[model samples]
Target chain A: MAASGEEVRNMQVILKDYVAGFPKESDMNVKTGSIKLKLAEDESSDSAVLVKNLYLSCDPYMRGRMTNSPVDDPDFSPFTPGSPIVGHGVAENLRNSSKFTLLMCPFPYYTGILGMPGMTAYFGFYQVCSPKKGERVYISAASGAVGQLVGQFAKLMGCYVVGSAGSKEKVELLKSKFGFDDAFNYKEEHDLVAALKRYFPEGIDIYFENVGGKMLDAVLLNMRFHGRIAACGMISQYNLQQPEGIQNITTVVFKRIRLEGFIIFDYFDQYPKFLDFVLPYIREGKIVYVEDITEGLERGPSALIGLFSGRNVGKQVVKVTNE
Target chain B: MAASGEEVRNMQVILKDYVAGFPKESDMNVKTGSIKLKLAEDESSDSAVLVKNLYLSCDPYMRGRMTNSPVDDPDFSPFTPGSPIVGHGVAENLRNSSKFTLLMCPFPYYTGILGMPGMTAYFGFYQVCSPKKGERVYISAASGAVGQLVGQFAKLMGCYVVGSAGSKEKVELLKSKFGFDDAFNYKEEHDLVAALKRYFPEGIDIYFENVGGKMLDAVLLNMRFHGRIAACGMISQYNLQQPEGIQNITTVVFKRIRLEGFIIFDYFDQYPKFLDFVLPYIREGKIVYVEDITEGLERGPSALIGLFSGRNVGKQVVKVTNE
Candidate 1:
């Protein structure tokens, strides 16, 4: 069995080792591996479609996959120690007769709003939140990929929406660009629980929990009776050695609150419906999608790690190739 | 206005002050106060109904009511420091023409298994857990009023259920009486997370969270993908000045677990449906109802305080009168 193909240098971001605390750029290595653009007759199979990777999504959830997962589920399993990182990415099928094609993908946008993150915001908010016309909604990590979309969705539903971000710029983006009723810099707040009370005098009806720990505890304190929490992501706890305990958790019973956690994979079957709804929102400028993109695959580690520290303004993406 | 009906001795348990940590028996002052058995001749209102207290339900949620609650909601508002404690009670209508009538009388059982705790277990398990046959279930505080019924419900559903209690007796009762697949004394297990893993090697599909804090943190790690948690109460945290931070809360995201908190007050409308479901089980002896009943209302302080430390064997009830 002779390997016969046109060999090309494929640049890759390989996981150097399993991460412990916060992931640093040093934990990943930029490696150039040779791969055949076209498969030989001997190796060609009906299912094997070799592709050229264009863009990679750098999400906070990737932090979990960086660690050696105990469970063997493919969706949540860890990245191999010395392999090209596996994530939500946009790829161009190298084979001319390829069946694998992303639908109406403008590659970068596909990594954010029009991709997995888009469906996440779609079902996580509408289905999980069960939003009413005049409900109050508070989104943590509001400038990020999912939060921004959720905020916009809440606004479209005539909700009083408030979002919190770590930085001043992201906070501004939430209000000015994403159409949040109001936005606050979480970093500036001394007492987060009290801060939420000030913001929600009547109390929050829906809490889009993105940053967990103190924020979640605070949100628990501020949530109104019969409030709904879509437990989407907990970026704050991802890198921590010890995750924070929720004090006001009992308030859930007192208030009859529903805190539901969901993954986008489970709801992927409904992606077509989400696209039907969101594509129009994007085309008509009803929703704003922002991306903080890094130019090269080599910068993937930094871009992905930046999400933990609130360095990425919106959806973090690594542009592997333009081809 | 002159007080008219025959005045009788109303032995009452009053909160001495707002509690800080674990409540003491001294915090509740047993006072012999005089109360009219009937509405005064001058104060007969069309809506008002006078009743003689028969039995009192001493539940864990009362710990929250002992503290001064910020929210003004009557269902959860704190008891006045010097007033008789407000809680679920079985009362006989002094006026023969009273509309507020108990559908079925047996007062002691009505205070527990047939009343609020019964409804809590019924809806909390059936509605919130979304249980399926042969699914794995775990319940913390499994020998208590609500937990006991929930375990029985799980067994009836043909699910493999494990329960944890603070006492060896309760553990025995869980396995022998309530028909739990397995039971453990959580106090004996130094490592609750490892204990849970040992019991649930495959992982938990449903977690009935009664004692929160460290127990909840452990349950999070043990939850199978798409697990549902009915956050009934956090009796453990109610005594603590600082609630223990849940370290594995991020597992809620990884496992896509749903942690829902509810009160029986919201589900009162569903009581008729619950009665239809559970009354048959109780009558057939398919379910066991345990009660650690105090002889008199004077002993209410000790019995109520006993719940926090897992002192009550089952439903802690104060038999105010046999009348």
Candidate 2:
């Protein structure tokens, strides 16, 4: 029980209060707490896994957890006033110290292609959209974590994929790195519906909805007959006090479209199947992932808040520890 | 060839102009045109079926056809100015005159339980919803054509069914005639979400969405986890220049709900199977239909317009001819 070089500083990001509108870095605080690295005497529970946090994912869905809204899901909960923010992370199992060396992989890989966003991309595209070969696929927030993977997956399926990103650099990354057939800076496009119509002249067969709000409204107007919308996340609407109205929803009826909302947690049962499907592509270098790593948990607040402002070019990861 | 004494006055309801807001009787004109009962010499094409129109269905979907908005469907077309308004009709085949007697059933039966609305109810409930026994089912516009059948079908499935309608008479019809577990007059209730919560304390498992706008918004807030919303029609929004904004749509994500929009025309191939499934119920008096029939084709304009105002109590039908 004596302090014998086992004590380590665990930096934690805590929520200051329930957020309103866009979240600010001031809404969260980074605190340091000491923890013993060794396993406790009563750590015999097989169900319990002690993990040393390495890489933490900053997802758009995290914004929802920061709000006081009563809408609850098994996948996520609202952030408590003075509690440590919890999300998907890549960690080292401290209980099985010897096994940690065997499980070690690139940290960025765990945060991107081998993580929650990767599973989300796999299920949202294949399971929800059911994209057929030669089908047209459009993805919003295309340079972001899930979006980038979805666009690549669509291309792998022999689909003609187009993506919309916020910045020019992200747009270039979507086209050059992610292998998207076409990419555009949505911020530059004043008329989103017209831009969609331009990209998908025959109309979009599958839409991987990530941005939501105006993008969704525009996409609704441009959807093809029997189109499928995989509503994985609505990043643009997450921080808004009042989500924008989708006026062209009647088009769903006319086109006989299917708009399904899903959480990645529901599809975790297929993680192994997804890994088997995706690992070959990753190993062969057919699928590439981009990561924007912000070192240290002290930068967690700014890194997490940066997602709302499109500051992160790719999968935003906060590196808590090298272990 | 000598002219046979087979000429009859073919009374038709013609669209005067593209309707804007709520349809007025003045938007349509009842016109008389003469037609010969005998098929022309060149009408031997196997694809073409000439029939004598009997009962014309005055459905809420027809309101969409009256608008000039260019949202086109293979099932329906916009009403042209100074042209006969075309829609789903119960008719007797003139080409197969000998088989007419065999097909002759109650006109109201064809308009209600054997026509488009019947198929809509069947597919929207069974296919889209996939209601399990003991599930909670909620139907909006509950005493109308599709709603009544959906309620009865849900009852037959051993599910607890609740319905919402515009008037007390319609609410009574839902409970008494259609055997809904509970019925409410939505017009009387100021807060739809609260009313739905009161009726479905555990939340709705299946929602047969007939009315859109506020009702749908309210239903979104009260849906159970993995709830199915069969978007058959949005009668309330058809006539509005600006449909009401659905603010609680994010609830679809939280609840892991499926909202699918479909046209009955797609399910026409399953008609024989549907007839086999439903005819026995009709014969056993397990299923009943209510029709608000307007006598003569001249009253078609009034009957069609009455749908927008919630004036027609049940399935609005214009009885054009008896034989």
TM-score of decoy 2: 0.95
Which run of 10 residues does model 1 chain A get worst, by summed lDDT? A96-105
Candidate 1: segments with Cα more than 4 A from true spot: A1-4, A38-48, A97-105, B1-4, B36-49, B97-105
* Interface RMSD (Å), every candidate: 1.3, 1.2
Give a tens-digit lDDT track for model 2, residues B3-97: 33477778878998998899898988888989776654455565456677888888888888887767656456677899899887777666565
Q: Please provide TM-scores, in order, for all candidate models, with all chains considered together.
A: 0.93, 0.95
CAPRI class assigned to model 1: medium
DockQ, per model, reads 0.68, 0.69
Model 1 chain B: weakest 10-residue lDDT segment is B96-105
True contacts kept of 2: 0.56
For TM-score, the strongest prediction is: 2
